[model samples]
Target: MEVFVEPQEGSPFCIRIGCSDTVLEIKAKIEKHRGIPVYRQTLVFDNETLDDELDVEGCNILDGSRVWLIVAPEPPQSAKIELCVGTLPSVMRLPIEVQVNDPVKRLREVVRSLEDVSLERVKLYADGTELEDGRRICDYELQDNSSVDVRIKPPKFMVMVLPWKADLKVAVEVKQLDKVKVLRKELEKLQPSLELDLPSEGYFFIHNQSGMDEDKSFQWHGVEMGDTIEVFRGTISR
Candidate 1:
C-alpha cells in the first residue's frame, strides 16, 4: 500500500510499503527518503500518535491515506556538569549545574537569574581567564566542579558624535552611569585632536533626534550602544 506522509514543514511525499509493515519500518523508509532521523519522527493517524510496534493495517491506515509527521526538537544535553561560580568583591560562591555543551553566555544568564543581578553586569572567568560569550563550556576543557569567577563590572558603550557643520564624526565611550553632561566634556577634550569647534557646555546642546537633558544620565534617556548623538550650536530653552 502507498501512504502520503505530510510533514509539519515542507511538501508532502508518498511512500510505498507493505500493509503489514510496522510504523517503525515506515519511519525507516522516511529516513531513507528524507534523511530525517527515525527517532525524531512522530507519526499521527486519525488524531492518534502511532506506536512504533503497530502495523499499518492494524491502525486502519488504508492506501493513499494521509499521515501527519511531526519532527521533534533536538533533546537537551543529558550530561550535566557542576561548577563553582564565585562573585568577586562579595566573594559569594554559587554552585551551578549546567549542560556540558551550554554556552558561556548561558552560564552568565543562569548566574544573573539566581543572583538577581543584571546580565550586562555579569562576567564569567575561569582560572583568571575570561570566558568568551560565543564559545561553549566544553570548548574551554572545563571539567566537573571547575571553579568559575563572576564579576560585576560597569557596562560602557560607544556613541557616535556628529559635530555640527563638521565632516568628522567622533566615537565617544561612555558609561551607563554617566550623566549626559559628561558626554559633552568628553567631546570637548577631543576638540584639539579632531579639530572640532564645539562651543562651551551651556552654549551647545546634544540632540539624539530630540534634545537630550544634560542633567539626566545616558541610562535614563535609553541611550544604547552605537547610538548617534548630534551636537548643535544652540541651547535648549526650558
Candidate 2:
C-alpha cells in the first residue's frame, strides 16, 4: 500500500505505522523526533479527527491504511509585546472531525472569505462506497495505503503599492531582522494595519519583542522586498 500523509508546517510530513499502534503512540513518536506540541496537534484519518477518549480503532483504520496528522498554524494575531497596544485582523481556523463508516469531510477556514472554500464539496467513490453527514462520516470504509488531497483556500487581500524609492521586483524570499521591520513600516504607511502576500510559505520567524505592546498585532514576519501582500486599501472613488 502506498500512503501519502501531509503534516502542516512544524509537523512531521510522513510516517508508516501498524493498525495496532494507538494515536497516543503517534503523538509520542512526533515528540521524540519533532517535539511538536501534543495539545496543538490533531491526528486525522479519512480527513477527520477522533473525539476525546475516542480510540483510533473507532475510526477503524485498517492495515496499510494511511492517516493524516494536521498541526494547525498558530493564529498570527497577538498583542504587541512593546509598550504600544493594537489589534490585528483575526484569522479563521476550522477543525474537522469525522466518524468511521461515514462519508469524507472537508474542513475550511477563511480569514476574509465567507464561503466554505472547498474546490469540491462532495467526496465521490466508484468502487466500494462513500458516506458523509454534515461534514461527518461514520460508515464508508477507506482503502489502505490510499491518498487524499486536502486543500484549504488561501486568504485573499489587496496588493500593496509602496512609494518607496527602491526598485522592488518579485522577491521569492526575505531574511533579516531589520528587513522585516522595514517592510512592516511600509505596511504601516498603508494604515498601521495591512497584510502582505508571499509567493510561498515558511517565509520567516521573529524573535519575541520585550518592549513593544501597542504594536502587538504587528508581528515582525520576514518579508522579501518583492513579495506581494494584499490589503483592502478601502473603497476607491469611481
Candidate 3:
C-alpha cells in the first residue's frame, strides 16, 4: 500500500509499504529516504498520535491516507522546539517555536502577547503536568512539536463539603475547577457507607444560611474557603 507522509515544514512524500509494516519501519524508511532522524519524528494520523509499535493497519491508515510527520528543525544541535497550545474540546492548536533553554517566563510573555491575557493568568500544562514559571522548557522534557494545554486561571475560592444529614463536617478544601461528578466519585471513595444518590440531572450545593441551588460550579454560587456547603444527593428520577 502507498501512503502520503506530510512533514511539519516540508513537502509531502509518498512511501510504498506493506499493510503489516510498523510505524518504526516507516520511520526508518523516512530516515533513509528523506534523511530525517527517527528520534526527532512525531507521527500523527487522524488527529491522534501514532505509536512506534503500531502497524499501518492498526492505525486505520488506508491507501492515500495522509499522515503527519512533525520533524524537528535541523542543525541537530539546535535547541529549538515547536509547541502546541490549546484548551479542551478544541483540537485547534497555536504553534509556538522557541529554544529549549528559554525560561518559561519568556514563553509566558509570548503567550500573553498572543492570547491577550495576563502572564499570571495563563498556565501551560504538558503531558498531564503543569509547567513551572521558574524552570526552562527543556527542564520539563518538552521535545519538538509537543502538545501543551493552555488555560487561563479563573477566580478561585475554596469551599468545605459537609454531610447534610450528619453532624460531621469535614473541612475539605475545594477548588473552583472541581467538578460535581468528580467530587461525588471521591466522596464515594471516602465514605462507602453513605449512599450518595447523585442524580444525572445535577447535584445541589446548600449553604447553611443561603439555602439550596443547583449551580454546577462552586465559585458560581458564591462559595468561599471558610463557607461550609451541605452535600445532598439530587432526587431526580431516572
| Regions more than 4 Å wrong, model 3 | 1-78, 155-238
Candidate 2 residue 57 Cα shift, in angstroms, is: 2.4
**What is the model-wide C-alpha lDDT for candidate 3?**
0.73
Task: Report the candidate with higher lDDT, 1 versus 2.
Answer: 1
In terms of TM-score, which candidate is strongest? Answer: 1
Residue 4's lDDT in candidate 3: 90
Candidate 1 C-alpha lDDT tens digits along 163-210: 878776788998877899998789778888888877655455555667
Q: What stretches of model 2 exceed 4 Å from their correct place?
A: 1-4, 10-20, 73-238
lDDT against the true structure, each candidate: 0.83, 0.38, 0.73
lDDT of 3 by residue, 29-58 (tens): 898889976656778999998877799989
Question: lDDT tens digits, residues 149-231, model 2?
Answer: 33333333222333223244222222333333344444445432333443232222222322222222332443333334332
Q: Give the Cα-based TM-score of candidate 3 against the true structure.
A: 0.35
Judged by lDDT relative to the true structure, which candidate is superior, 2 or 3?
3
Weakest 10 consecutive residues, lDDT, candidate 1?
199-208
Q: Order the candidates by lDDT, highest first — what do you get? A: 1, 3, 2
